[model samples]
Target: MRQTRRIAETPPPEECDPRVEALVNDLIGRVADKWTMIVLEVLAQRGELRFTQLFRLVRGVSQKMLTQTLRHMERDGMVTRTVHPVVPPRVEYRLTDLGASLGAAFCGVWIWAEDNLTRVEDARARFDDRQT
Candidate 1:
């Protein structure tokens, strides 16, 4: 059985290319990771942030992992990394229009979760009860 409703049973929806589908899957997988969402949230709230600032703001994430996430975001054209030539070399990151739009889109998910928290909790409780 299909989990998602299909608008039509025959012809598929528009923009169903395999390459696009694979890219969407890869990007979605990356965004669904714990650190990516938190970093996106922190950057969205705080605007531009330096390496140390991000490390501090996004607590519990190691420096190495943060570096990787930032790199991935940069490669995806979601974030822009600026390097400042200074005594210690300062690098700051800010979200591009794409990243900002993505953040805004995910904000809708947060709103939905907040709106349905009680219903979701009730469902979870009912599921747990059945397991026992």
Candidate 2:
């Protein structure tokens, strides 16, 4: 009997063609931040939110870190920021069309995780039982 390796459905393009390595690297580099997915999800769900709202929505994120993440996402053309001339100078952040597309991608992954979380927990419990 021979054992066969399970091939990944979406292997890195470079494995098939070297020409795609640069593109893969660029795409990975752009979204390499831990907070990027959360930010996208929040923006997707809320449409537009102020900095303070985001701080509350995403737990454990510092104000400075949130500001920096938003700035980077804005620079990457994934988010847009609007400033109001109000007394306190209100500023709001929202996903651009491009950002919304990325947000949808994140949402898809999030859904997959949520759907499989129970299975994952069960698997972990079984594994731990085996160790005991």
lDDT of 1 by residue, 3-114 (tens): 6544485565576899887887898899998898898999999999999999999999999999999999999988999999998999999999999888887787899999
Deviation (Å) of 130 in candidate 1 = 1.9
TM for candidate 1 is 0.86
* Residue lDDT tens for model 2, 62-89: 9988988898889878899999999998
Candidate 2: stretches off by over 4 Å: 1-34
Say which candidate scores most in TM-score.
Answer: 1
lDDT of each: 0.91, 0.82
Alpha-carbon error at 84 in model 1, in Å? 0.6
CA lDDT of 1 in candidate 2?
94
- Pairs of residues clashing in candidate 1: none
TM-score of each: 0.86, 0.72
For every model shown, the clashing-pair count is 0, 0
